[model samples]
Target chain A: MACDLSPVLLSVRVALISTVLNMIMGTILAWVTENKRFPGKNLLETVIGLPLVLPPTVIGFGLLLLFGKHGPLGYFLAEFLHIRVVFTWWAAVIAAAVVSLPLMYKSAKTGFASIDKNLEQAARTLGSSETRVFFTVTLPLAAPGVIAGLLLSFTRALGEFGATLMLAGNIPGQTQTIPLAIYFASEAGDTRTAVFLVIVISFISFLITYGLNWWVDGRSSMRKGG
Target chain B: MLEVTVKKVLTDFTLEVDFTISDGILVLFGPSGAGKTTVLQSIAGLSIPDYGLIKLNNRIFFSAAQVINVPARLRRVGYVFQEYALFPHMTVKQNAMYGIKGCKDMDGRYKLSVLDVMEMLKITHLQDRYPVSLSGGEKQRVALARALMTEPDLLLLDEPLAALDDKTRRQLRGELKELQRRWQIPFIIVTHDRTELNYLADAALFLRNGKPYRVLNRNKEQPYD
Candidate 1:
């Protein structure tokens, strides 16, 4: 039957891993850029955001060049700990993550920027430390935006194609994710599998986006009512 | 007595404000963008100036030459932001207790109960409500109660009455004035509303384009208009 669940399962794992890593990195990046004013801050933002504008294939290629076996980073890792990233699950995860970074960063940054600065000032004046203010006030208010960004990033990672393909070749049960599965199925004239996967992915995406909209709408209404 | 002097230069305007308030209301009266709020912000340690100094009861809050800038958490100042800036996610009770620590019940400490401040602010009924669910006046009262919970040495109100309706403003202004009198804490209120200034202020400091244009004592006058 060649009932291939490899792409389905592996892709889900890759998306999950990529989403988690992206959420952490994107949050930290957004917090830094939104709050601090260091030297060349604009430059740093532009550089960090380059992944958004650059082609996904280019990003994959860049990652490959920087972290391939002969690459300095890869060589150091191999010599130190004998870990190979090329054509591995980690590579697929990183590729998807790079493609999805800007989604998280942009959304989270907007969230952080929209928060009232006066609330934090008031907290500080009332004897709350910087750490306490962030956790208690800033994080709570920023949760909705962060959650929205994370979910969007997860969805994008689920559909990541160009970067994933370029960085990690489609090895069945290894680096082959759902998108790759759909592509290979279509190429092989297995229309039933392709159509089924497409329908499943479409249904899930639809549900997620609809759920997000409902949540945001309910949140705003709840706020207004409260 | 709290004497603050700070010289801060924003991109558009330079703020060089100095004043001292021992007791009663020190109204920072100014038109919009006159840097009146900047002065209060500097006092609260929110805005740090490039030069000058701030001293509260002989303790230096900020000293450019000494390179001493006391952080806001240790300053014991109460601030009411122009919009109140209540915590939208928390209930009114949680908001009231937001900045107050529990050290008062444990050992050598001073504290006010959340219930007390809520009752004082007349927000006891709204204790379970969030900021988004609160009316403008309710939010202001909650902000006041939250700031009061810390039992601050000096209170700063940055146009606290600007967001309410005329009737609500008039009503809250009276309540705020009464509260101020009862608390007996020096207050620095930034506002251009002459009505509010006349009704609540004992002394008025007029700011024109980031400078103190004049300082008037309203104690003797029977406020009109």
Candidate 2:
């Protein structure tokens, strides 16, 4: 009875899905925010990073206001489209994406900013289109930073707790990500399962941190030595 | 043939310059901060001057009144920077072949393959090497090869030999002059060094504070030659 396999597997599945989806959105948004500075760019950056500092419950409340059953868009979706966002896997994804967005954007933006603008100018002179230059020179050069951002965002999404719990309500198999499972187990007086989840989360966090450091340091040394 | 006349007023200096080149090396000579390199940049379409005209081989590259400003890619110009600015990530071969897009030979094949120029510059063995791995002279050679491989109508070098030591600079200068003689294209060499102006220049134009002050005829009045 203590070793329930169902919820653990469900937690991993939800975490993985949320991480990958958030990473994709983070990469796209990061590239746009860093590469192109238009009117109200600062405002966009602030909005993207808002969830990082805002209370997790506040974020969940905000999402609920926008996507809950009685919420404006949520009611329309349920009535017209029959889509449920609250207490669902999709809500967990939205929560994770919101919280992890800043990590991705900051990492990618720094990476793109560090690249030499002259390289792009040279490519333009060589008859490369704007799109080609971005793909070939700019993206490759900024790749390390992008990878770093991805790892950071992935780790953040995996550990998402407050917003996930508030918005998705700790559904046993549907919305129970790793962090939520741990919280729910501890609340249910199942210290053994809670401790088990904690250890796993700790190990994952250690591995991701180590991987990011190793990658970034190795690149720096290679560049310096060369 | 390349003809250029442009003017730009910067905070510290005003750049008003004019020159022409045809099938020979033309040197822009002046002291530092003379805006000689600005003239070359303007020709390459890297920097636009306030008011002027730039025509390469009878094609107007930039004209203020006509509102014509051709981008750098369409200019078909090969610019060798003072720092070389070779792509650090690419090998010598990749750098050389960078500008050889849509090239065709007499047989309608891609003409000016990087291998030929690699051999011509004696850089065949160094093709696999990166810019960071090469010495100053070797980098200069690779940069020169890269620029010439483009088969441009005109070549612009901004103190191409300025970064090397005296011995290497002289050696490269001799090689560059000889290379110019072998190629059938207009060349513009910008440098503040009188020694380089004397050695490589077919004709020299002196710049002062972003303006052309003197046009020295190499055949008649070159002090060093």
Candidate 3:
């Protein structure tokens, strides 16, 4: 029997959306925190990074409280905006994004920090505006770290399970990602389907890791050659 | 003409500088940690001073009392860093053209053209190369070309030849002096090399402990050391 491919498709879509969101939010947050000083900066960074250490179920519970039907946000969103987010595909995306944000943030922060600040000052003296300097110099220099962060977030989102299971539920054809589908397949004595999904996930993970290694190695070699 | 009277207090020391530059090269001669770079930075609008004023060509670049601090991009000053600080990701051509595209003068025209600056610096052939691929002298020339693309009223070079070998430094010193004479803009150079002072400086300012110790005019044959 041909195995269903819907779960794989849904997983890829959710991961892609979540990774893009993480990329934007992570890069901005990293840049701001790296370059600016403000009161309570450390606290803010710690709070954003909490998800990395917290249990996924705990995060899911928090999200559940915020987005559940009787919850304040859920009630306001449903009654006023006539929109529901719980147990939906968007909920999976949000869950994955929240869980994977810290990884991107940390990597991008390091990237920005490693750049020589004198370069930016030189640009300023050359009559480039702050915005132009950032786009022309800062961002390009930090591209490798940002790209690495993006790939890590993408893979993390693809493998997300616990929070997604809690917030989005295991609704077939809607929110049943590969991880959840594999779980259900194993529990239902469908060993073949579970094995297939495990292989697919492993293969994807290998490709991502290999790609990251290749890119990093190529960059280092170019630097050495130059 | 540029006039600067600024005071900045750092954790280890306080920088109190008062100087004036009309035209030709003015060298800031001092040992390391004498706050030479700080003075240059303040003039370039990169370092904010706690008090006093910086006037360039009669325009108030910074005035603490009046709160008239123009942003760095509008200051129209070229600063070439000691490290040459070229954007490693950009080609020499892109780096040279960076300042020309974004800045505009009062009448709404670019200050200088990339082609003109690159040709003037003789770095037109290296425009397609990246900074990492260029030799130290080539990098320095590209940096100067990039800075000149803005058509600055004043040029500030912080230890411009410090990173090159002795032979390269000797050759470039003469080239730099010739360029300054041709440009006719006030050039402020920070260096500890006494020979460099004799070779290029029309005047030299001796700085010690973050303060101006003395000002010497090369024409007067004042002892620099």
Q: Backbone collision count in every prediction?
A: 1, 0, 0
For candidate 1 chain B, the 10 contiguous residues with the lowest summed lDDT are: B102-111
Better of 2 and 3 by lDDT: 3
* lDDT by residue for model 1 (B80-163), tens: 998888887788899888777721223455567788778888899998977877789999999999888888878999898998
For model 1, chain A alone compared with the true chain A gives a TM-score of 0.95
**Top candidate by TM-score:** 3
Q: TM-score order of candidates, best first?
A: 3, 1, 2
- Which candidate, 1 or 2, would have the higher lDDT against the true structure? 1
lDDT for model 2:
0.81
C-alpha DockQ of every model: 0.60, 0.38, 0.81
Model 1 TM-score (2 dp): 0.92
**Model 2 segments beyond 4 Å from truth?**
A1-37, A68-82, B102-110, B219-225
Per-model CA lDDT versus the true structure: 0.85, 0.81, 0.90
TM-score of each: 0.92, 0.88, 0.96
What is the two-chain DockQ of model 3? 0.81
What does candidate 2's lDDT look like per residue over A38-73, in tens digits?
999889889988988999889988998989888998
DockQ winner among the candidates? 3
Which TM-score value belongs to model 2?
A: 0.88
lDDT by residue for model 3 (A1-226), tens = 2388888899999999999999999999999999999999999899789888999988888888988999898999999999899999999999999999999999899899999999999888877788888889899889888999999999999999989998999998999999999999999999998999888988998999899999899989988988
Superior candidate under DockQ, 2 versus 3: 3
Model 2 lDDT tens row, B116-197? 8899898999999999999999998988898888677788898888889989988888888888888888789988888888
